[model samples]
Target: MYHTWMRFFTPSPLHRRLGLVCLGVGLQHGTLPTVGPRTLDHHVAVVISAGSGWYRFPDGRRTTVTAPALLWLTPGVPHHYAPDPGTGWDEGFVDFTGPVTATYTELGHIEPDRPVVPLADAGGPRSVIGRIARAARRGNPLLEVETSAAVHELLVALRRARADTNADGDLVLEALARDACRPLTVAEHAARHGMTPAELRTAVRRGAGCSPKDYLLGIRLGRAKELLAATELPVAAVARRVGYDDPAYFSRLFTRRVGTAPVRFRAQQGRTVPGGWSTRIPDAEHPPTIITGHV
Candidate 1:
């Protein structure tokens, strides 16, 4: 036999529009029998924290599972699994879904092909599950929003805890970010790291889930936005500062990507100081630093 405690929820359309909603959460132990051979309409992250098990796909391939692993049951995917009757297992799970799931999948936060994933450690994911559990309490008015917010944290924790990510890739991403404002092409950037253009693409795609150009453009556009909003810089100057040599090309690119021309965006978002932009507080007047978050 097995033991379990679970709570399911039906969030309002308004809550679902928040981009991720937790549908349920639970803790289970003992030999859990078999599950699914059925498909689900949403996603579920079944975190196996202890014991051992095996899972099967519709193709008849079966794989062994150990503790500190995760089983991703993505939408419309058929799944089947069970805990070993002798050893049993401890399991915690959170069910979630939203349009952001698509983005997460694109970003490699959710893998459709690989369902049974080994994790480096289950502590971070387990903590998020506990938060979801606490928010699932009955009569809690903030249940929907709180649980939904935790779902984002859960994804991030899972990403960080994955057993297979390359540590060296983090260095690549960091270097790219540091050099993002340079007028270097992806090929030039790749050469600086002694990698081919194709290799650079692979590294960037694995780490950031986007191409090198997209990543650099994201940084450039963000810095351009800060300059436009905080300083009275001309659009042409802002474009050149962000590495765009041609003002007309920059304006066109900005307009196409941001849905507004540079001048128009500055007009809408620019800061107008009552005094000149020279108001600076003394270092002694700065607020004290405070560390904060849930325990």
Candidate 2:
């Protein structure tokens, strides 16, 4: 693998909202900088397209990052990196600042210090970033939409990377996801798959990067997020649907996991849970106005 670092800057409403500095990265070759340590003004995400390298933070913490790895640098974090002595590095990075940056921060995808997350495989993130870069270069009117979609795909790929590490662990996770609404203990789940609870737990930890209980909680929380965003269900009803009988407990859990209460989340999204299940529509005295003209 080769080693390299590149940066992109862009100016657009979408980019401004996302705090993204550049778009449409291209393949390039360069020597790693030997400059003094510095902190970025915005979030920086680095995707190694090719190569391996060693990275160091101002705190003197260091980690060797390989190609197909992702490096996240939150604003005000002091960091510097260099290519490996023998094998150079090839990488692309973008700087962004925006409302959605907090979302990534909450997901732990962005690190305050230098943290390199190795991908399951290189191709997925590379393709996504490459496509976004290409679209940005084209300067199309829909660049924002395309870039946002690509960024989302990149995030999903990163999330799935953890699930891809263990053998058959991804399949087990998939099975669990299919039945997330149902309550099942580790032993019961393992018994259905001919594996012991201990073995299942180990596999889950390896694949999900969390304990079985934590994984289950994540599933419940994800379902809660959907309900909060898309439905008019009361917090209690949503909690019950996700397996929590006590709305207070569910509210606390939601706050811990989602960083907000269910009601606030819905409100922020400009939605409301209609009370009493009424299907009322305002009656209009006049028909809606429509204009039709022949060209």
Candidate 3:
């Protein structure tokens, strides 16, 4: 047996900092719309819980995204999609806007001109969205923070999807992920893979579903998230450890990819501050971390 629920959040003038909408649907045996391509007013994260569907973008690119896959919809992108007529579909989705939404928009990851990028593993995201829906239904005060974190998790999943698609891409991404916490360059990575930088870029795009540079940046950003969440390390140190010698540049990249400055992200995670100041410190007891950082 399957059940469905949906929640909608209207923008409140009193609460200017956050916005959210959640939708859950269970089709025992039904069909979705065959509407023409339409643009969204805000960003959307879709998780297919059961059955499968076909998505078509304005550019004519099409992909059959199945259950346990995610769809990212950027505002203003023309897209049209429908569920598999026979199997019907069960899905959950959340739409949100905040500082992080703007950041995603700026990073080009939320492509307004392209179709949704399917997450390799949609289970985590689906679970998070479910939680968000429940929280909203209960009118939880922490909904803003929870929804924001859930969206971040979804974004991280998308980045992993981009890197873990095919074997060749996995090799390049694995190499990048391994060295992301250290200083690494495109040429150096290419040499390690026995290919020129150009060839490596092409290979990465085909295999990982994104360019080599984007893949490396994703790796570094993923690491930055770990330091922000687990350690009291200063943003500067976190930047350096993640291969950015310049803290300011790292801040920009982090804000762009993560939708908040490193300091803010940590604060949102409920870390304590000292006399209104938060300094980053390494965690002695924390185990060696993975690139995903639990996102």
**Highest TM-score, which number?**
1
Query: What is the alpha-carbon lDDT of model 1 when measured against the actual structure?
Result: 0.88
lDDT of each: 0.88, 0.66, 0.66
Ranking of candidates on TM-score, top first: 1, 3, 2
Number of colliding residue pairs in model 2: 20
Q: Which number leads on lDDT?
A: 1
What TM-score goes with each of the models? 0.84, 0.57, 0.58
Candidate 3 lDDT, 17-108, residue by residue in tens: 54432222221224665535888767676666667879886878888867666666667677687778777676767776655566565554
Candidate 3 lands at a TM-score of 0.58
Deviating ranges (above 4 Å) for candidate 3: 1-4, 11-30, 33-37, 59-65, 105-109, 113-119, 161-167, 177-185, 201-295
Model 2, range 144-256, lDDT digits (tens) per residue? 66666666676666665532455587778888776665667768888877889898888776566567778888888877776666667688988988888889998998898
Q: For each candidate, C-alpha RMSD in Å?
A: 4.6, 9.7, 8.7
How many Å off is the CA of 111 in candidate 1? 0.9
